[model samples]
Structures are given as structure tokens and as C-alpha cells.
Target chain A: MTDPRLLPRTIAVLGCGGLGVPAAWTLALDGRYPLVLIDDDCVELSNLHRQVLYATAEVGQPKAPALARALLEVAPQLQVEVRQGRLGPANAAALLQGCDAVLEGTDDAVSKFAVNDWAVGAPAGVQRVASIAAAIGRRGQWMVVRSAGPCYRCLFEEPPQPESLATCQIAGVLGPAVGQVGALAARSLLRVLAGEADSADGALVRLQARGLLRTPVAAAAACRCQARGDGAADSEPWGQHV
Target chain B: MFERDPKQLFDRYGRQLLVQGVQFEGQQVLHRLAVVVGCDGSPLAQAAGQVAARYLVGAGVGRAVVPQGGGTLLQQLDPLLQLAELPSEAQPPVVQLWFAARAYGASADVVWTDLSPQGPRQVRAGALQWWVGGPAPLTDAVALGAAVADLVVADALGVEPLPSLAVLDFSDPLAPRTRKHAAAAGPPLALPADPGSPLQELASKLSETLQIQQIVAAESARCYPAEACGLVVADADGQLVALAVANLQDHWHSQDPEAFSRSARTAFALDERAIAAQQRLGRRLVAIWHSHCDVGADFSAADVSGAYPNGEALYPGVAHWVVSVRRGCVAEQRVFGLEGGQLCYADVAVSGELAGRSGVEGRC
Candidate 1:
């Protein structure tokens, strides 16, 4: 009963690490659209446990290209591309131009918020973006941000102090925990593409430790991103001229 | 008849018995006299001889004699055993005097005395009534009151004198007191439900798409020797409602096992066709599902790098789904989305038939 074409017009994965590799593989294997896999680092031995994308033999290999090749082999019909470079402020717009939605999986909160702001300032077609802060330790939190919703900055307000933020390399993470949050992110994007249209415009979903696994719960109010008077009327190059 | 010295009689029973008597104005009348013996003494032999003399005097066979030492002393030892010897009329009746002494030391000294005088005169006149009354009921009541007061003080100080006793008193009759205390403590506060604000929803949506892509790589693990792949589409709430097959053909043929390589051109064409078909249906292909077979659910290095180029060339915002089925059952299913340009996992939620609370209440 829903229009299927309303799914992502363009999709991009910005990191290919413990969390990113699995995400990119899922998208490409789905063979849904032009899927982009990007990561500047190479696969390391220390990443094998949580990052399911690389194996022992693949150590020291470029992660982006490795993930792309593996995805194509599985789904020969998928349109997959790889960019072996770091994602930062300078190239953020160019990489995100045609992307209808983006998944922010970088460990840094600063980078995540930067993605959120870019998604908001980009054209309408490029506005939808989501991030997964999958678990701090054995547990993880998954959140989805849309261009229409409050950006990451709206919920967190400010990034945590550098000393407080823990990266996967430093703090360690449970592989399954990352998998669980990542799976939730994929589902949210699919829903967005379906145009369920409501206040999905400015909503966020948080997963908490309810019992055995984390349970998803919704926030009570709209985000500050949506609260800002940045009217939806802004025109950008990526906006669809419907 | 023979006369016996009083000192000799005293010597035989003095150690085992107490002799009590009264001297009236320097005259010895032997009146109000009693002989008390230890509980282990032989008092029965002494009582028999005294009864014979009394019986002889009362039956008109008067002046019948008995050994001097046994005369009154023996009769005082046990009166009930000698009662049958008295005549119906004119019987010089037998009497018994018993003295119970409370002594603290081993010596024959009496600290207190309890007396029972057995005779018709004492019973008929009701003169011994005081001896039969024991301690009064009022004394028992006082003892009980003191015990209850001690318990109350102990409970207030939380210093239970007897642990089991306190438990019994506190819980035995009923738990009314504890219940009252618990009620005054109050209940804990509850947290608000459904905190997914609008901003979180969008973030969750974008994250879910990436998760779907991850699931695709997971599924491909089922066909390790070969390659298995599928696609998925989801609703606005990030629920996978539909799925399709992506690659149904072989993209590689190797004659040399050591030099085997993936047929990149053939794979690209197949992947493109699958993406095109999903687009034609007006549905956004949220993810591509695949299997890894025996090799396990992890993405290979080739898989990671391969995803970037193929992903950017087709869809930029879409994610991937991988379902890994091992030996017929699903071992794992994951999703992948883009974090910057790198492939990372995205979280997802599978929708069920349960109606949303707001929807069921018709609030929207």
C-alpha cells in the first residue's frame, strides 16, 4: 500500500570500522540503489572482534575498497562504489551532494554533529541523515536524525568534553551490541523512505537497557533543530524541484 | 518400763531431723512439738511403734507400753499409717505435725518454715485455712506487668533481648505495625515513556537504513563458496516490510584456485540490474541482503572496499541488509549505513502488528 520508490534517493556510509563496515555491507548486499562505502583507514587486527567486515588475512588492507569488493561478490547486482579518503568539513558537502540520506557512524561526536548540520543546510533531497551511538560499553544507544528533525546538536546541545568521550579503540565494545544498534539504524532509514510522514520530521529514537537487550523508546518533544526558525522553505542545489 | 536419756534420743536423729519445741516460763511442757526429717530418712519404722501404744490405751486395755524413744517421736513421724488402731469412741486420736524448712546452707538450720498440722480439731475449726491458700493472684499479675514493660523498652531501643522472642511478638499476632510503617514510606517515582523526539526519529531513520545494509553482508555469509544476496524495503517507521533477491547468477569462474579473482564486470552488471528493478517499483531499496555460508557472517576486506565504489555509484543514502543462515537456521542478520564515506553499522527496528498507544487511543 506504500510507494516503494520513496526509499533513499541516494545513500552514503561515511565510516567503515567496527560499526561502519557491517552497515555498508548490509546496504550494498540489499542491491537497493547506488551505495557508497567510505573509510580512510585500513583493516587492523585489533578490529576483528567487533568489526565483522574484516578478517585475519584482510589485516592492513584498505577498509573501504575491501568492504566494497566483498559486498559486490555477495550481491553481484548491487550498484556499489568506494571512496578511500577521510571525511571532514572540506569534502563533506561534495561527498554528500546526491545523497538523499546519510548514516553518521564516526566515533567523534563533533563529526556526527557536523554531519547533522550539513544534512540540515543541504538541499531538501540531501537532508535526511542518521547516526548511531551504539553502546558505550557492553550496551549501546541508537538514534536517528533526519534533516527535518532536530540535528545531533539539538539533542546533545554540545559535544561532551574530550576526556569524557570514549572511542571503540580506547573503551572497547561488544560486537553484538554494535550489530544491534546498526540494525536499528537500517530499519529507521527504510521507514523514512516509505514516507510514513508525520512528525517523523523532528523525532529521535533512543535505545535503553531494558532487559536482555536495549529497548527502543521515542523522545517526548520535537528537537531544537526543528525549533529553530530555519524555515523549510530554504532552496539549495540538492532540493527536488517538485 | 525403762527410761531413756533425752540426749541419746537426740543423738540418733538429730543429724537427719529438726526438733522444734516451746518452753513455757522455765517449765518444760513438751507442748507444740514437731520432728522434721530429711526426705531420704527412715521415718516409717519410727511411726509404727508409737501407734501400738496409743491403740492399747484407747481399747480399755489401758496402760499398754511402748519403747520410750518411740512413743511420741514415732507417732509424729507418720499419723495416717496408724489411723486404723483408734476405737470408735474414746480413741486417744492420733495427730501428725509436718515441718518443711527452707535452708540455704548444708547445716541443719531453718531459714523459713511451712507447717501442716493434721488433726480433727484443726480441720473442724478451720484453723489451718491460711496454710492451704498459697501465693495470691495479685502477685502473679504484678510479675506479668513487669515483663511486658521490659519488652516495650527493648523494642524501642532496637536492642532485642531475645531475637526469636522479638520476631514472635512483632509478627505473631499480626503485621499491622510494620504495615503502617511501610505505608508512610511512600512509593518511588516513574520515568516518562516514549522520549523519541522528532530529531531522534530522523536520526533513527537514517541509522536504520545503514543497519539494513549491514544485514545484507551478514546474509551473504550463508553462501561462502557461492554468493547469496537479497534486498529489502522498509516503512517510514524503519520496519522491513518487503524483501527481494538481488544476485541470482554466478559472477566468477576460476580454473586456478590459487589465482581466483572476482569477475568485477559481471558483478557490476548484476548489481545494477537489481538496483534498477527496485527503483522501477517506486520503492526505495533500503538494503541488500546476502549470505556468507560456511565462511561466517563477517564482511571480508574485499567486501568492505567493494561496498564503497558500488554504493556511491548507485545510491548514496540507502543502507544494506545481510542475513546469515547457517545450516538452515538464521545465525545472524545485520544492517550497514554510511558514516561519512565509510561503511558502518546502522541500528534498526522490526515492526510488529501491535498498535501504537496513541493510535489505539485515537489521539492523532
Candidate 2:
């Protein structure tokens, strides 16, 4: 098998909100992997505080294209593809086609799990890695899922009810707090690409009030990821990609 | 001797002002906070130096002193942050971020990251030390840079109490371990009052906790050689039940040896589904019980990170009982919990026998 690391990998970023904005920007600044930005939401006046990629003048513009333009303006060498649409199980494969990794930063619970399920369910030939991150009210958590480790569902079996948990819209969030998470997510992806996947994989890194706390997570036997055949068969020989 | 228009500052940093700690006074502290990024010839160090500088500027820090070649990206990232030269005379409370190896200095607080024989390590000193290590890779420089910036900001904002020393091992990145030492006297950060012993508190409050030692002892002995894990849940009747949740460590290690390097013999992973089922029982989770084979009954670093995942308690008000299983016999047991934001453990005498469901108490 060809060494996948030798090939230039494409990354698909889901959700262009607080976490995605900085994540996309950080990846663009790195200027290594080609990026595919997907988001149906438009730039809002309220998003400017935490979503640093958008400006006041760009309000009402689709987030994916606006972010692409913003990235190109700063680092013209970047290869960025814009897919302006909502991502679900149906279109996840098409939207993330030919991508080696996915950075899921969507705010809602449904979209996050959808991305997780899709990644965990990928076939042998199309095995891909993913990093899912969420931020709200001064705190955030990010985890990277690879074939060898636990999927997002393994840690959080299911998302809590909307009423039970407060979204950033309701509880409020600081710009720097989410911004820090976004950067962490982007850096984590870079680690995976740089052949240092351990630092970013399988563990959940929480951005707490004081410092970053990382907890190791394992696949639950009952979790679908554990029964996943593709995860075992298609997992690249470790260190080959590096 | 610093004066800036409050209206303009608010216009730029309005969202920051809304945060609790960064409300007017904290924002001023951040604005007054100066960080020095020391660079070296190494490419990794240079990249990390630049990442730290950019992050500090984006955070609305007042002034930054970057070694000449490093501030090129700072001006483009943010124009508000003033890039100044290193101070000549007595420095005033500046946090220094060193990307290369350096001896600890007395004057300024330091967030240091260096490549070591073991791996990449980060040390944050505000009268505290946090040493995090994993394999040495190029990304370590960038991760360390961001980590340093976070520590600097946390110190300025007083987000977390400073521990005298915290050793974080990422060798097994999947299951990282964090061990914290109590802060020394006269530390920069204020220490909160002691919350007292969690083991003693649990023993006194719950009669079952004291009586169920035999149940835990028998189970630990049964799961000998392989580490055992379970939960202590209170049913609707408010009766504490010892439920043996599957370890799942060996299962993961067998499936993915590269990621899960440790097996059931040395480590333990409680079933997430089991924990969630207990969580849904309306605040019935009293404590998570597990056995450490040959590792002693005291709470290990893994226990600390597992119980308080994300710096917040996974199960608030939940005490963790760690039983030591030595040579197929229960030697001792201890209870651990978070007290005043620190992991504190107390030894509990194994006494009393309770008749309950035996052998594989609950689902894996």
C-alpha cells in the first residue's frame, strides 16, 4: 500500500461557527493540507465577537465562502474549497469526498453526532480521521477519533436534551474562550497530520476555567464503533502515515 | 501610567468585558499584562515562539517583547498590541514564554516548553509547575506555544489556583495522567480553605459505604490479575448498591493495541454506558469503585483525571473508592474526591460484610 502520509491529504471542516472559524483560520495559516469548508449558515452581526473570520461588513454572506475569501486574502497560497450546505448522513460522504480528515465544530448536538456516526461508519477503502470540538459559556472540549481509538459516541453515548444543556446563544460565551478551543482543534489536526496523532487522538481535552485537562477514553463494547469492522481492517499500519 | 479610551477599548473588546473574570478589572489586567517570547535558532522553537506571540496579541495583551525576528506576524494579527523591546532594568511582573531550554529565572513568571530526552515538556511557573510530556514531534512546539499562552492568560485572570507542582504524563496519550502537588506557602495564587477528607465524610454519612467493604473486597479478589471497576449507586429507596461495571480495558487493548497500549492488568476503563445509566437515575451515583492490581489503594493519577475529567467532577458529589488487590487478595481500600479543587484521598478501614449480588454484578 502506498504511504498515505506521502500524499497530500484534504481536510473537510464542518460548521463555520465559533470553533470552526479559528480552526479553519489556523489550518489556512499552516498552509499544508487542502481544506474543504462546509457551512450553510450566513455571517451574522452577532458572530463577529467570537467568529474572528467574519467582519461587520460581511454580515448576511454565507459563512463557507466568506471564510474562504478571508483566508485567501491573508494566505493566498492556501487551497480552500467551499461547500455551502448543511451536512448530514446522506451528504457527508459527498461533502467530505477525497478528504483524509474531518474537523467537526458544529454547535448543535445532532450535527455533531451525525458527523461522528458517519466517520465511524466509513468503509475500509475510505477510512478517515476526525476531530470534534464544542464550546459554550467559558468552557469547551475537543476529541480526535481515529480508527485505532474510541469514537465520539464511545465517550458521550448520546447528546443531552437541548433544554438540559445551555448553548452559546443562551448562556453566552467569551470570544477568547471559544477562540482558544478553535486554535486547539486546529493544532490537534496538525498533530495528526504531522505523525504525532497520540497527542490529539483518543483523549478528550477540556478547556476548563483553570487549565487544559485531558482524559483518556476507550470504546464501549456496546458502542457501534466497537463492532465496527472497517475500523480494524482499514486502520493503516501505525507510523506508516508519518 | 497607562491610559486608553474606555469607549474605544470597549468597542474593540466588548465580548471580553462580559466574562466574569475579565469584566472591567480583569480586562485591564490582561491589557496591562506583558509577555516576552524568547526565540532560538531551532525551527520548532521559532514556530512556537511566533504562535505564542500571535495568541497573546489576539488576547488583547497590553505590550509584548519579542526577540527581534519573532514579532513579524504580531503586527498583522493585531495592531492594538504594542510590540516593545525587552526591558533593561527591573522588570514589572512580565510572563516570559521560552520555546527553548532555559534555567528558571526569579524576576518574571514563566511558561517554559522544551524538547527533552523523554519528550516535549511544558512548565508553567506562577509559583507552580506543570510538566506535560508526550512523544517529541514538531507539533509539540505549536501545542506547547498554545499551552503556554493559555497558562499565561489563566494566571493573569486567576482562573485556576496554582499548584506547587503538577506532573502530566502524556506517554499514553489515550490515558494521560495528572498528579498535582499542594502549593507551597506564600504562593502567588490564593489557596482556598481545605474541604476536609472525602473518605471520612463518606464513611460517616453512608452506612452502606462502611458495610459494603466486603462486597468490594470479594469482587476485587475475583477480578484478580485484571483490574476491576464498578459503581456505587443509590437506588430510589436511597440504598447504596455495589454494581460491578465491566473494565473494557482488555477489550480495547485487544482490538487496538496501538492506541490502547495498557491492558486490564495495569489499567481500568469503566463502562460509559453503565455510568450513563446510573446518571439517568436522578442523582443516584454516589461513587465509582474500582480496583488497582498491585498499584496500591491510594488514588493514582489516572483516578484523579478519570474522576475529575475536564477539571470538573464527572459525577459531582461522587466519591471514588480505589481498592488495592495484591496477589489475588484485597490488601486495602481508599476513597478519593475533589476538595477545594484538588484531589484528596483518605484511607478507609475495610470493615463489615454485606450480602449482595455476587460476580459480574452489572452489564459490561
Candidate 3:
């Protein structure tokens, strides 16, 4: 039997775009956890390709509520909480306070790192693990982060300047590229929630143009995730504690 | 962007146009190609097919040949993506994406003909297999479908060379592996055939196997440290009865360990004379049941070879049941049979009562 504490009761999805749509749908199909959808952006005609939830009718609508209504149509009995708000440093903690796990699919790199920091520094009472994913053109990458393994910052060091990176809009992302990354993100979070985090953590999974590559990620010497704070004891509930 | 309808194309595919290789030339190429997404109507395959189709259409592909009457949402996906029931017989460059359900999980294959000016030469193809455990078929479908779509879009746009095969092994939920093998002399890509299942026909009679289950479990526990073998046959009255046969694995191993490397504890071999005698008595052989000392009730590769040598079934309709004996007690039992020329399994739970005394064992 799985430990009740190990199972996530509530999951918070940080983006309702290409990645968030499929991730939330997969989680909703699992029917084990109630989802909290968060995104302030509105649907657009261009998003219909990659983001499976929205149609042309819902193009001008806010993403979170529209996605919630779409998921409800698939599973009328599903419990879906919608939050039409972007997750930034100001509201990241409050928006994700009760969520046991976070699936971050937002296109913003800074926001991805912010979610990572918040999850790594979360208080002991709150169980938090973040799966951050991004894709551009024909390639994508995703990673699972928790207290026990290398966090997002440990692998990438720091978020690149917004000017340095080509946004999905600028470089253009294939629908399947981003969708696969989102599905993998959801798979990673589900693994962490099931108390099977060894494979999910400590690695960066890249869906390259050639093939899928999973490379081990080492924690930086000065990385904040290396600090054995109150989060270190989190291994107890996950059955990883020595 | 074409000078005739730049605004409309820009409105829908402006983002993808900004991509490196897919600038203006690739977009024109995509618009001329037709992709066919095939599904076998299983819930998992259809869902995956829709996912792949949506990606191809979204990338501004000119036309899509998909299964008709199911993709109402796909029609709403894009107006430029002409949904067709069949591609024209003309020599247009076409890509094929096939979603199939296997015994373990599911598989997707993408085959595209590169019709350059030279000619439609050898077709380039790639395959993706997602092997999953548990009831998370939806997640695997999403991942598998999206991966297939990536292969099509990337190959169409000339982004990079595609790997011959990619396998996602989620059988071990704790540690899933993503293996990408280099191109080799693999079997040619073909449409997946829907083969008839003999396993389902055999499994329908599970309720009548209660007495036979008890006998097999008892015989298995008593024959611990050496594999127990038997044949389920009908008597003169056409009633099912268990006939325990001595496993020749131990005898052969003792005589020639080098020739028969595995011990009797792990392997089982039947005596041809005992089987011939049973056939001579005019008994109908139904199944062959054996025990695995300390493993789960799974039809392993060796079990398949022992039953079907060189892809030929020893007995055409004989069902194979594997009993798992953990610590000298029958833990569980499962039925193994053929499906699509592959070994598949059906699980059965048995409340086995461990017996002590040894029973009659037929020898050569």
C-alpha cells in the first residue's frame, strides 16, 4: 500500500499553454489528484496547434478558466480549480501554498527558476516538487526537482537574460515538440508523487531532434538546493531516508 | 510566405515561419505534402492518432488523410489542413503515421517517402515504442503520440536525421529507460495487422479450472526444489483431470550438466514417452502447467521458446498456465497464449492450499 502522505492530494499547474494543457489533462485522467490551473494569458488563434485544450471559439478567453471548462467537459465529475493569474515571485508562494506538487510549463525562464526556488525552499509541512519543461522548434527539455536532488538552478546555473533566449514565439515550436515535453513533465511529477523519485530526480531529460537523452545532473557547490534545510527531512515521507 | 495569401498564412503559421530551417522553403514543402494518420479504433490508438494529426496540421501541412467520422475536433483544428478520407493515387509525397497496440504497451511508426527530383527512392522511416505498466495508458498515449508527431515534423522540415528506433520502457515505474538505437537492418515498416487471439478463448473457461487449479497448485508445492510438470487432459468421460509427469530436467542435468546448464529448480523438461502414452490412450490434452519457484507469474521469454519452438506451436490449441510458487507455496497463477504471433498473458488469482505428500509421477 502506498503511504497516504506520499500521494499528492492537490496538484498546481503553473501554465495553461501548450505544456500545461496536456499535463493537466493527463493528471485529470489519473483522477487521483485535484488540479489547480494557473495562467493569466488568453487563448489565441496561434495557440490552437500546440495547445490541445483550446479551440478557435475560445481564442480570446483567459487560458485558465477556458482550460478548466474544457477539462470539466472531458470529466464532468473532476474537481478543477481555476486561477487566472501568472505565477511570479510576488504570488508564487500564495498561489501554490497548498499544492503538494507543481507542474511548471510557463514559457518564462525566470518564472521557471522562481518556481524551482520556491519548491526547494518550501517549509517542511508542505510537500513540493516542481517539474519544469521548455521546448522550441523541434527540440525540448524537462527536469524534475525536489529537495533530495539537483534543482533547476543547479543544472542551468541561472536563468538566461530574456534577450539572450529565443522565445517559442520567436523561434517557433512544433506542436508535438512542446506537447511531448509537457507529457514527460506530467510523467515526472506523477513519479515523484508516487514516492519514486530516484529516476525522476538527479537528471535532465532532453527530447532532442535525434533521440531522447537522459543525462545525470550534478548539484552545484554553491547551489541553494545543496543546503540541508528543513527540506532535507522530506526524504522521510518519500521512503528515501537512510 | 507566398505572395498570394501572405496574411492568412502569417496569421496561422507566423510563429513556425520564424524557425531556422522552416523559413520559407520548408513551409512551402509542408504545404505540398500529405500525411496519413492511421488508428485501429482502440481508445488509446485513436487518442494518439488525433494527437499526431493535430501536430502535423498545426505545422501547416497542406493535407491530412486521417480516419474519417471521428475527428470532429480535428476539423476545427485548422482550415488549411484539408482532412481527406484518402490520398489521391497521384505520386504526391505522403507520410504515414501508424498507431498500434502491442501486448505490453503500444507502438507508433512514421514512414515518409522523399520524392526529390531524382525520384521516390528508398523510404526513410522511424518507429517509437512506449512500453508501460499500470493503468496510465492516457499518459503513455500522449507521450507516444507527440513523439511520433515530432518525427514527422522534424523529418519534413530537414531539421535533423531521425533515429531508426526509440523505446520508452515504463515497465519499471521506479526507473523508466529511454533507449535510442542506431539504424540497423530492422524489419521493413508495414501496417500492423489485427491478429485473432486464442488467449481470450482459452481465458473464457477460467471458471471451470477451479479443480484443475487446486491439483496443479498442490502438485507444484510438493515438487519444490524441482520443477513440477503436468498435462491437463480429459478422461473417458471427457472430464478434466490432472496427470503429473516427472520433470526430465533433473535427470538430464545430472547426466550432462554441460549440455543442460540450468538446474531443475529453474527449468522444466517433459518426457516424450509419457506424452506419447497419454496420446495413445486417446486423452484430449488441454494445457500444460508448470511452477516457477520464486518469481512472479509472468510468461517469460524462455517459457515462450519452450512452448513454441522456432515460431511453431507444439500443440495448436493447448493453453499454457504458469504457477508461481514462493517459498514452497503457490502464490499466483497466470495463463499464457499466442496473440498476433506474440506471447501474451492473462492473469488468474488462485487461493492455493499447499499439500505435503507426493503423488504419482509418470516417468519414461
Which regions in candidate 3 have their CA more than 4 angstroms from the true location? Answer: A1-6, A219-222, A225-229, A237-242, B1-4, B33-35, B40-42, B65-68, B85-94, B111-125, B133-136, B161-164, B170-186, B191-364
Report the lDDT tens digits of candidate 1 across residue range A86-136.
Answer: 666577777776776676666767666666666665553334555544444
lDDT of 3 by residue, B200-258 (tens): 54544543566776777667867875678888776688777777888889889999999
Q: lDDT: which is higher, 2 or 3? A: 3
Where in model 2 is the C-alpha error above 4 Å? A5-8, A16-18, A21-32, A39-78, A146-149, A169-221, A224-242, B1-23, B66-78, B83-94, B101-135, B161-168, B178-364
Candidate 2 interface RMSD after superposing interface residues: 4.5
Which one wins on lDDT? 3
Tell me how each candidate scores on DockQ against the true complex: 0.00, 0.08, 0.47
The model with the greatest DockQ is 3
Worst 10 residues of 2 chain A by lDDT: A220-229
- TM-score computed on alpha carbons, candidate 2: 0.55
* Candidate 2 vs candidate 3, TM-score winner: 3
Candidate 1 CAPRI level: incorrect
Highest-TM-score candidate: 3
Task: For residues B157-238, write the lDDT of model 2, one tens digit per residue.
Answer: 5554444444333434455444445444322221211335555667554434554665676777688778888888878887
Candidate 1: which stretches are off by over 4 Å? A1-5, A124-127, A197-204, A208-242, B1-364
- What value does the lDDT take at residue A143 in candidate 3? 86
Writing each residue's lDDT as its tens digit, candidate 2 over A1-242 gives 33556543788889998788778867876777799999999976556556655655677889999889877975699999998878766777677778778888998786777777776676666556778999876678898776555778787888779788876655656665676677678777666655554555767898775456887777535455533546545655233552
lDDT score at residue B308, model 2, on the 0-100 scale: 69
lDDT of candidate 2? 0.63
Error of 2 at B127 (Å): 8.1
Candidate 3 TM-score to native:
0.67
